[model samples]
Target: MKAGREKARGAWQLSLPLMLMITAASVGPGVARADAQDLPIPCANFEITYAAKPGEVIAPTDIETNKDSFWVFENSGGNLACGGTGPFTCAGLTVTVPEKDVVHPSTAKTTINGTAAALGEQDQFSLTSIDANDVTQTCKGTYLFHVSSNGGGWGDPHLTTVDGLHYDFQSAGEFTALRDDRLEIQTRQTAVPTAKIPITNEHTGIKHCVAVYTALATRVGSSRVTLQPNPNVEESRKGMELRVNGKLVTLTDSGITLKASSGEQGASIGPAAVGGIDGHIKKAADGAIEIVDARGTQVVVTPQFWNGPNVWYLNLKVYQTSATQGTMGIVPEGSWIPALPDGSSLGPKPESIDERYEQLYEKFADAWRVTDATSLFDYASGTNTATFTLDEWPYNSPESCDVPGQTPVQPTTEAVAQAACAAVQDPKEKADCVFDVMITGHEGFGKSYQIMQAFKPIGTGTWYSPEARPTKPPTHQGGWVELLKKWWWLILLLIVGLLLLLRKKK
Candidate 1:
């Protein structure tokens, strides 16, 4: 019985060590595996370069104003042809008026100094036809105007007629006050021309025929004038009014219409006149007046004035389709169009891609340093796995362990990675660049490996990751090898015990 007991004890000791070794090799350490929480989150502190499309304007293109006065001219249908014939043509007329001082609160008149010239190919008529001789002449003159308030109304009555060598004209007008320091004027006038020629008859040796020609020299519609306050002049708000005639008119960006009003009219002049007696009024950038006619002809009126308190002097330049005339009127200049509020400028500018990549890499590094799982996932690819690899096992070195109160050293060099990403032009490709991070310092015994986290672009210089990290504990060092190394003495004991039992049996 004693011999049998000794043999059994030796057999049990040999098998026990082998059993423990097999068990240790099959099962791993108790610690949990490194999860996404252990991974480094990519930062987004990067800049991005963007390109603008062609003709992309960042500022406004039109002029805008809140207040101003305008001298608008509406055309009245009148045939001013010299002689009624086929292909009717009229001589172009230009007038220049010198500035005059206004005499207020009195019966005294202000005299206008100016000259008038008749132009175009139709002004050469100097012939004698039996009873009458026709002569073409240029007339120059001055206008005397007086302002009186007689309680009933205010009138700018003419003190003297516009009398020249061959023409005599008189006008009566009233000024109506409007809101915001504005005034409207309506005027009516009549002109007559007299020509004397020598006639020889059969009965009389020599005779004179006096021909008095009558024409309607009247302004049919009203004109508006606003007081433009000059910043340089104290309490100086002075302007003039204008009246022009046309059949149909429209206002366009390029120019105005003076014959038949057509095209797009941005704003309305007044009630539309039937049978093509309409006109358009537009304000230019320099406070000039643009008038268009039905035939697409334009007349630009620019005003010049001395803005003095109580009294003002005004001069005007009227530019026709091809000709320009200097006269007397008021022009409101310096109005601009409103612009949209975008940061873009009028032209294109350059942006840097390398700088943007550097910023992005820095952001990623920051997130990784904190081990922020959420931020890491957000900046990584949604479809690909966020992989992690370790050069050495966990707890192999003090720096590799996740100990309390210890910051982990980042494994990857951010500058090198960022440089690589900067070469990629495509946004998606840049975002998908591999995030190879190495974990340096961890306290726990859990093993960690190198990481390759996938990322995708989420637009507007952002990236996202979607894969979950592993949660199971890593196998301790070497699977079966480690187990055998730890329990090799047990195997030797088993071999010795088996040899002793065999010897006893022999």
Candidate 2:
């Protein structure tokens, strides 16, 4: 029995391919009808001419010809594309004759009256209304009709009804119906700053939720709501609220809670949160209180309105209690705001940010005058008597330190020493100027030798001078060339000779 069954199955399989071949041969060659192969293309027909003035309707001449001879009548059922017999199908009926070339006419003459005075493809339209299914409201106005295709599928001439609503799309074969509401209400779906609390509030120490609202319009109701901190000041907090269908309702306190009414009926569990309600019904996580009416159910007593701040105490108990409203429930909370930018914990303060600017300025000026960096040293009275010298170390941008008669230039060491010696009457002051300029300007230029020969004598008060010179010599160690070149060389030699006698005896 098994061998026989296998043999029978193999025979059936062999016959399958032959059956398909027989069917194809019977169909015949080139039997496809032109009408079947080329289906009827849907075309839109409308009055293309319009009145020059507004609020006026213009009639157009008949477009009957070989091209528009056959047309499937339009009805509530939709455009019918049935006629002729062949592989090429004809849908919505089309004119076999070609349309007149209106753009680039042979001559500029007015032959057809009210038949598109302007030269172009049909650029005019006729007004009509769409009343069927979910589209009930009577649409009143002119509809601009055009034909478009998405390559894979071809659509009939579509009529665009120009209603005021921007969000609603008015076209044929659309899943969504055109809304009758004003465009402002349809497209103006802003967040409105009022919604449920944010989901992250629980983690940030916010224990409460609050909401407030104020209705602005009648049919087009508008409201403002707010969420605020609850009574628990020690804990962190966050909150938000929302408005539905022009109805104001805010969530506050412990945040939002959701619960299901029945098992298997479907439900959700999540935190109470706030976000933009772009014209849709919102409900509690447990499937309660949809802000948007997607179920098409009538709602009695829209959710409570809230604006400003409110507090809420959220928990399992609150979720169960809120389910009774058939929608979401809300509460009001409040919080404190700051009066100024800085805290006053430090006590009453001065009027300005910097109260000691004036005192600081005075101290800076006094210190600058007393301590002069320019001048020369003197030995008399073992003190320096010289003013600051800029000659030896002139100002880089001399204009910075140049007085009325001073020229801007780099100061020579000799000029600086001379200026230092001339400025102060005290030998020590003069020496200090030379030392300061040399160290600061020349990177210790001749400073060591100047200090040993000039400053050391004045500092010890051993070598005295009858009068301090207007300028002082270099405070560094005296060199042989310098001693031979100036009168100071003879004095130095005498002092050395006198000290030799004492040294020999020792």
Candidate 3:
């Protein structure tokens, strides 16, 4: 970019006339007429920057007049182009030039000192720019300019000013009196704006609005359930209980109780219950809940927003712990989807109500249940060489699936397996539960071990079948016994009477 300064043949033709007019109107003793020599190049300054996303903006600041002279520079990367749209525009000092060479003059109407300024019909203004993001290209585009003039002020670029550069810049890089002096300006290309990530909740029937704050406390869905600010009685009062899967939970001042599971409210279960964590439990003072596993690991939950009634944002976290360490991770919230009351659903089928849990169970159950080296590798969220073997079957049967891991303190395998199976109605679901029960024994083992077992590995010497086959018939079937026959003579007489009546009728 060069300084907008150069003498033209018509410099005097344009300036001389202006100078004569100024002198004729002037009564000063020794004031000289304006001339190229009288007024040196206007020193100016420029600023530039870029924002690469929609709703993002970049504008130059600290603008100085001709005192600071230079073009604001910006680098446009390959495949990138830069220009202002909407409220954004290229603005600077205004300069006047002949209507014939004014470079894409804008026909925008405006009032100067309460008088409408008429735009000339001649195509005087011109603007150009090179494109370099793609294949070989140079400045080859032109755009119209929003032109305006004041007694001696900035020439406001109207909203209509599009892409490309405006040349007719005054000595001060602004719109001012132009006296036939040629000006050349150039602008480097820059990146265009793109879209941004949206924030939303994924667990429940609540909508959360994201805002900037000094600090944000959040949890991943993999962490244990944590409630903030012990559910304020008032706030919690308005809160309806919902199953983790969004089943309608009946609410009471005591706490949200699972409606489907009577008396199993958050308040009903002991702190040790795994699935029934007190979601509304809060910190003593901070109003945050920190659910820690036996390994002293904290659970972090993600908020699942409910789009139904647009209630409060709900977050959930699950924690897995070992003797030495525990870990937590975020559960991603799905795109905004409608949520219905517990047991009910938003989709066409009621079965879709537990869609997430069902989907996740299917996706992870196989990996979680396989306890061999290969199974571990298949589902391992991390790398560990540990292997697992069941001594006497830690998990109760599927029916009592909620029973915790056996450590001289839990129920039998049959009980837990029964519980798990009871939770589902489908044969496939029961099979999955049975499978889960078997894998629980092999849990830390690598998948290779599982493959070695022919994928039919047995646990605790107990044979758990997806379908229970009856071994023998019931010997104690205690219903009503049959009676012996005793009415032979009466039956014979009834038959004889029936025959005689048929013969008489014939």
Better of 1 and 3 by lDDT: 1
The lDDT for every candidate, in the order shown, is 0.23, 0.21, 0.21
> Of the pair 2 and 3, which is ahead by TM-score?
3
Score residue 84 of candidate 3 by CA lDDT.
35
List model 3 lDDT by residue over 164-243, tens digit each: 11111101011101110111111111111112111111232111111100001211111212122112335543433222
| Model 3 error, position 85 (Å) | 7.0
Q: Note the clash tally of each candidate.
A: 56, 101, 88
The superposed Cα distance between candidate 1 and the true structure at residue 42, in angstroms, equals: 64
Q: Whole-model lDDT, candidate 3? A: 0.21
Expressed as tens digits, the lDDT of each residue in 222-283 for candidate 2 is 21111212224333133322332323355443222122222221112111112211112233
TM-score of 2: 0.14
Candidate 2, superposed: residue stretches over 4 Å from native: 1-3, 11-188, 191-506
Number of clashing pairs, model 2?
101
